[model samples]
Target: MSGLKKVIIPEMPPLEREMIALRIANMLEEGSYVNLGIGIPTLVSNWIEGRDIILQAEIGMLKSGPLAEEGQEEQDRINASCQFICAMPGSSYFDIETSFAMIRGGRMNVAVLGALQVSAKGDLAGWNNPSRGLGKVGNIGGSMDLAVGARKVIVAMEHFTPGGEPKIMSECSYPLTAKACVDVIVTNYAVIDVTPDGLVLKEAIPGVTAEDIQKMTAAPLKVAADFKEMEL
Candidate 1:
């Protein structure tokens, strides 16, 4: 046996965060071409290493790198959401039309996205809010193309809203970007794989019992007996 040290358990939320990232990372295949949506999806690019995958940012940058050093950000260098950063070698730049064409043309293999709600049928609701209060008007952007065009789609988000409303549901009430497109849902509480039979709980985060996850979820979740907490 190797002389590696045994690890200690971490406290809740941060551990949950890492487990969410890891669950998504484990799905990435070598040489796969992927487009990452904003927020948590953006963080996955930083975690991937020694993988032959190519990362495509929707804002016209290919082979996008992590945020650059304080003084290294160039005015013209930006990511999918217009965040400034340094570009990787062999990076390509183009207009949104061309970039979106790559997504819609079926050249990409996967798309990692963040969502507000995901239904049992694999419908996604993330681009807009249907409520009355004025909030940031969410745009569909390339989400429509990417969700439908990619061979696989992964959604990373917390399990529930601050008000404790479950994001995973029997049916999404908000407008959907795509129908039956999501392949996986990674949340702070568990890693779930989407199936025709509803969400499959593949891994429950440590300290968060399986019963705890099921109780918090809006839809009936099927748990795998071999479930384990995801490792980053």
Candidate 2:
């Protein structure tokens, strides 16, 4: 935890589709080679059009651009989710073997993934929803590999479940995709860091206090000394 000065906050809206994506996109560093997982994490490319980050798709894409404009996509250009996407000027494509090699070799700088549950200790469980019934689970795909392969893993999703339950907890009740792999968590309500001390609150959405988010999580929170409301 390095020193981060405070910033002015604007009014926050409910977590619409783009808000979550914006939060994640803002965390990217210049020249980072990042892989975005399916679901909400896929929306990140839409928000980072001008950034220098390289968007890597496990199905063999490099330097991919944002989602294609409706009806303006090339059928051959798609992402890991099989969704149409735009390619950057110097974008290139390869084979699945090459894609997984880059990931498994730890060449990716970051990975943004959606999660069903994330613990204060950084354990992730996005692959399955245990209560959904036997034989009904979400796809694991390459998330397990990307979680540990990337230099940093960031979980992006709604702050709570559809039933208004906290997604961040003291311990995950579902099957974990990876243990202690998440470095940061960006939710609609706040940005939290999984530090050795505990879940540390780094920033909060506007019009909300740090205490407001603490009550929503099952885990104990550590507010930074200079915690500020998020400007975005």
Candidate 3:
């Protein structure tokens, strides 16, 4: 948070939450076993209806569908966020033990999760937001296991905090969810890869330049050779 100035690019309007989720959904490969965390990640289910991807919920649900319509809600059919969801055909249910086992056992291929902060080295600080209180512990839920156990972790979140602070930092100020666990970050304005070298900028929204993104990012960003406008 040091030496970072608060700034906003009015010319480059950030993508809407739905568009962010849609961009993430398009990146998932076919036949992948994916988990959608709460918040923006939960909206991904709505865009993958006809895809071959299989969605898993930590609460013992498999092949979970999009959020249920107003009149189609089922009390027992809910995602990890506790939002009612539609169950796709051939959906299966299991006990909590089995559900966690699948996660900790490394059965999940990709996990789309929200983040409070991500370090340049790919450290993820998502579980506890310091604003809650000095020592209050936020519900960690299954993020720890998913961060380490999943083959790939993709964080979907806004580029900056509501107060215009950069969420991607040189070092996370909040408690870490996992160290060096993030693979990709899909923010509203850019798509970044957390590589061994550093955070690489792969894509950005039209009209936004590398210097523009650099102004908002606390960590140094390496623009990929093939950088291009995001395909929103």
Candidate 4:
């Protein structure tokens, strides 16, 4: 929507879903208490084995581990995605009320979530896509609380929709999950930081330039001084 002209990017290989999860995992610090939202964010646990980071599930589990192997799933041990997960030693289980109390009380260090659109000012819109006609019926779940309560919020999502529309925009066209709550965005094509100055392009996939990413994003992107190729 800005005057920046769109440029066609040469077809480039994007990061695989696992790689995206790894990239986000690499950004976490030791001793972090993290909440992974459904979708790609749920994969982060698989890459964090042996790390000091602890995973939390809104469905009343803490110290959650990676996804369960085939035929290893237990009916009661699941993450927010409804996928069976392994539980770490000292894992704790409680009711949803206690789980949300931890989230709302701001005890989480980070929350990795999926998003539909993120604005230049770090606004997140993930709960509903109006085009689906779900309207108020769409599930909001714990996204709102996590976005607001986490010390940092990182969005892990694809850079574009199936129709090839950019998910990073000057303003969100969908209903917002929270305002200016996103801190970082890791996509298949690039890693960006949402800052007071603007969106900063941090790391991009090999062969893609900041200019190429800018053409795809609706908002302006400021290239970080340390910009470099994203590595898993």
lDDT for each of the candidates?
Answer: 0.79, 0.85, 0.90, 0.91
- 3 or 4, greater by lDDT: 4
lDDT of each residue in 208-228, candidate 2, tens digit only? 888787877778999999899
Candidate 1 local lDDT, residue 164: 55
Alpha carbon deviation, residue 137, candidate 3 (Å): 1.7
Q: Give the runs in model 2 whose Cα sits over 4 Å from its true position.
A: 1-13, 70-72, 135-138
The TM-score, computed over Cα atoms with residue i paired to residue i, of candidate 3 is 0.95
Tens digit of per-residue lDDT, candidate 1, span 177-216: 8999999888886788898787888887668777777777
What is the model-wide C-alpha lDDT for candidate 3? 0.90
Scored by lDDT, model 1 comes in at 0.79
Worst 10 residues of 4 by lDDT: 1-10
Q: Estimated TM-score per prediction?
A: 0.86, 0.89, 0.95, 0.94
Candidate 3 Cα misplacement greater than 4 A, ranges: 1-4, 134-136
> How many angstroms is residue 199 displaced in model 4 relative to the true structure, after the best TM-score fit?
0.6
Candidate 2, residue 145: Cα displacement in angstroms equals 1.0
How does model 2 fare in lDDT?
Answer: 0.85
Best by lDDT: 4
Model 4 agreement with the true structure over 1-232: per-residue lDDT tens digits: 2233444554998889889999999999999999999899988877888889988989999898777899999998988888888887889999999998999899999999999999999999999988889877799999999999999999999998766788899999889999999999999999999999999999999999988998888889999999999988
